[model samples]
Target: MLCAICRRDARGFGFAPHLIRVAAPTVKLCSMRCMDIAARLKGMINPNKHEAAALDAASQAGGVYVELLSRTDLTTWSEQEWGRLVDVIVTEYQDTLRRAYADDPPI
Candidate 1:
């Protein structure tokens, strides 16, 4: 396997075992430094996935739960409708952040 960071040959690997022996798979790493670099690389490669993961982490940390309700079709909406939709989304975002960080003001 290639190093996720420098794209060279991997020197080591990381792993997490499942309930069964065959279910366990390895996570390859070129070095301990590359292990950290791999995670960072993953976040950069797919930010939406990382954002979901971060929100899940925030929930675990006692923050407000995050849920993606639905994907909207903005192109079909009229200008006024689009503005309304934007307002709703921005308001929801503010509410979620406020709940997530009650100690902070209007995050």
Candidate 2:
């Protein structure tokens, strides 16, 4: 696999344990620096207050990611950061759906 941003081979000797270096294209983040930058930029519109309310609403559906996506504040984020936030939220929604519907029926 290649790092999404850097487009470099991600199979270095110590890459396996980290697991992030080889993330699939859809999940590819290149580096924690990229992920953190994405998160910080997108944090503006993705305020923690809004995330908490959404988590509460999703709890009834037995979502597992209620803990991860939950935010508190987005102090200095920019509007341009909404793009990454949307990406993360969409992925989280799919993961939550799978967990909610696993084993039993949809909630």
Candidate 3:
């Protein structure tokens, strides 16, 4: 199975919230790196303490897009960069929903 966070092969590492009785669900990842990243995404880790370099590397390795959506240092980015980030996020969300419902019957 693909890593739920980065779309890479699971390679035997994975997480299942249900195993711990959490409502969030499960995810498979290729390495400990992705497990940490997924934890950060789920707010289980402090993003500030963990540098962005790791995330950037993981994103690049998995062909996943990265964006600084909630970064407090937004002033460092140009307006065009912000616009592009928004576009990427919106496009990704739409694509996910499309794929999710692709096989569902019409209402």
Candidate 4:
């Protein structure tokens, strides 16, 4: 499928969650870059140096993204950029839901 970001023949097999451009379509995409942020805010009030510390590295990078959001005034940005942002957000969200219910029976 085409990448929402580059519109190229993306490594992402289809129009899926910000399916990051990987080396190949056969490769699975990661939930880490996106979920690391959620995991941190969900409970980790502070950066943990414990077993979950590995997530801290990714979470910290996610934190930088958060900072970037607040640091910039989105209104001043162009519509194209905002639209692209929405595309990625929506894709990621759908992918999250799919994973969360993957093992559950459908009603």
Candidate 5:
């Protein structure tokens, strides 16, 4: 295995399995140092707990859309179904924005 961060021979590859099997399935690093560096490189090279939780929550909230879109004939949805899905998504989005700007002056 090669270090994903440095492309060097991955000395850290051995520990990768027990460390974070899910997140870095294919990523192999020469050492723990490279993994640490990856988390610092930003762009969620390794998302923190808060970031991961937020993402998970967002996905959960979008479950309706994902479920519907996964169908081969999503266009067959009834008007009410589409309306309900869009309404849920819009409400979730608005709530997120509301939380984001909670400390700012009211609109």
Candidate 6:
């Protein structure tokens, strides 16, 4: 399966909302890199505030960071539909990115 964040071949890393009942589906990721990206995107960690050192380290290691700068437009969806919507949106974004940069060398 494609990684939820980068559309790469997954290596088993994953994320899922922790709920006692009605758990959201798990999101498989390609690597810890995409996992961190997903976490930051979900607001689980504020990378801008708490991960400065890690971000700097990644930059030094030749990692290129891309962020979704605009707010997501999910206001039309009901709260009960958010989990499915999130999954769909993430997958779509990953596919879009893959196609958009298909010819580019890895960063």
Residues 61-97, candidate 5: write the lDDT tens digits: 6686768567536588778777776666555644553
Where in model 2 is the C-alpha error above 4 Å? Answer: 1-80
Give the per-residue lDDT digits (tens) of candidate 3, residues 48-79.
Answer: 31233334433443334333344546687678
Q: Which stretches of candidate 3 lie over 4 Å from their true place?
A: 42-107
Per-candidate TM vs. native?
0.28, 0.26, 0.35, 0.32, 0.35, 0.35
Q: Which of the predicted structures, 2 or 5, would earn the higher lDDT when compared with the native?
A: 5
Those runs of model 4 whose alpha carbons end farther than 4 Å from true positions after fitting are: 1-71
TM-score of 2: 0.26
* lDDT per residue as tens, model 1, 2-104: 6433334778664333423434344565666546544433423232333344345444433221123232455655677656555554445434533533333
Q: Write model 4 residue lDDT over 1-107, tens digit each, in one string.
A: 43322123445232222244322222222344323332323322232232133334335544455466664577776777566555554444444444443433122
Clashing pairs in 2: 48-71, 48-72
Q: Per-residue error at 77 for model 3, in Å?
A: 37
Comparing 2 and 5 on TM-score, the stronger one? 5
Better of 3 and 5 by TM-score: 3
Residues 23-105, candidate 6, lDDT per residue (tens digit)?
A: 45567788887776655455232223223433344343321212232324557545655555445555455544544334332
The TM-score ranking, best first, is 3, 6, 5, 4, 1, 2
For candidate 4, report its TM-score.
0.32
Q: What is the lDDT, from 0 to 100, of the residue 101 in candidate 4?
A: 36
RMSD of 3: 14.4
Alpha carbon lDDT at 13, candidate 4: 34
